[model samples]
Target: MVDADASPPQAGEPISEQEALRRLRQSEDSSQQYYGAWWLGRMRSQHPEAVPLLQQALRQRRPRDSGDGVEENAVARNAARALGKLAPAAQTAIPDLLDTLQDADDGLREAAARALGQLAASEAIEALCEKLASGPAGAGAQQANSPRLVEPCEALLEALGDIGVNEPRVLAVVKPFLEHERPLIRSAAARTLLQLSGEARWGELLVDLLDHPQLQVRRAALMDLGAAGWRPGFQAIAATLAENSLKLMALRGLVEQGNGDPGDEALLACMDALL
Candidate 1:
């Protein structure tokens, strides 16, 4: 029943509410459906009516009898992401979004978690906690794996952090993952822990990550510590103060910690050298 323009809107073109609504009905092509959902999410602030349409898209299932291979799940997933972009305004969709978190599709689950986070859906915190504990829904190798299974897990953890559920119980739930073999997951856990507890223990854990061989892991830790005003890692962060790509984050961390050498002198000298 959904319908939209057969052709997509021109790039950089500002689509009106009517046009976006039209796009959401583009059921013929999954790609068109995706674009419609994406644009609707992007422009959701201007058109609150698009929210229910997006939820409808999320509810659609793949046509089993369709000879043409349409990615119905993908369209639905995009719908979920668009709802996430709609964010706190999309709070009315939380029940559906939370249900999507348990979807068989890992990517869809991630999108749902992100949407809940944006809404700051505290009602979903316990569910998010359980998702982190349970890992992704799968059989065989996925159950025992760490690095191989990253999507929804990382997404869920990041969502929990964004939702600001930093309580002792939540910290307890997130702590064990600090030792995860995969640096990416470890970084995610570290970031979440920092957001929740900001305890010296988590700070020290992040400090150690500065030496991580994976640049992404190190960057994640540095960014979190810097933004949180975590001072425990100042020395470790200082070591990277001159490295390219990481220096600015390092400086941010140091500046936030109030560890600057009493004025614009030392920090400016370092900046000049780095630049």
Candidate 2:
């Protein structure tokens, strides 16, 4: 929770790179630390020197609740994310970030995976695949943002895709997630598959998933279809345009495929039905 009033400076406001770096090193409060990390990434993170500072920030941990384990270190997580923005410049941090994959904090693990992908550190692919297959480290925690902690499998899947690793074993780990009971997981799996495979069949698979009983699953399918610019199932997608919970997702898919023309009688009919 960064309080806007207390935050260092808004995005457009001018701040010196040296000052940002100084704040990043000097800030003791988590919120301030997060703000500093963000500014550093946005301003001059590409500089090689930013890597060590960001790594040090990631090493700082907040007190943990022994009863219900959750890493309360927003600062470290933010720093990890900052390192990700640095990309190849942060390549030196790969080994340390790799170790972070086993951290008990789901958010930290997600951040580390994101950094690895950004760096395109192919060496970490096998370790990430193993984590995806075994499931993310630590039990789920009730974070303010979500009742469920960040799901590491999805993060790992996305990371692998970002790094352009399309190995059969990687595919094998991700394939099973498509049938996961949770729609969010199913959605992440679907998106990652499309990103890695770029196969029309995967898009078609998402189209089929539009018929799933859960609105969450249907939403995920529609979103992926839009991303792929898939047109084969516009009819089924149009039908969902009338569903309150799925309406936006369905419309987004139609729009992406340029199916929103007023002259298209079927699409107009679907839109009219919504009225």
TM-score of each: 0.72, 0.67
User: Residue by residue across 147-174, what tens digits does model 1's lDDT show?
Assistant: 3463466667767876887677777767
Quick one: best TM-score, which candidate?
A: 1
Tens-digit lDDT string for candidate 2 (1-275): 01112234345556677766776777555555677788777664565557888888887754456685543566777677778778767878788888888787766787788778777789888888777674323322234676665456656766776677778987887877776655666666776677677776766677777778777667666665654445555666766523543554455545554432333466546645655
- C-alpha RMSD of each candidate structure in angstroms: 6.8, 7.1
Clashing pairs in 1: 2-25, 3-25, 4-22
Against the true structure, candidate 1 reaches a TM-score of: 0.72
Error of 2 at 23 (Å): 0.9
CA shift at 42, candidate 1, in angstroms?
Answer: 3.4
Candidate 2: segments with Cα more than 4 A from true spot: 1-14, 66-72, 135-151, 207-275
Clashing pairs in 2: none
TM-score of 2: 0.67
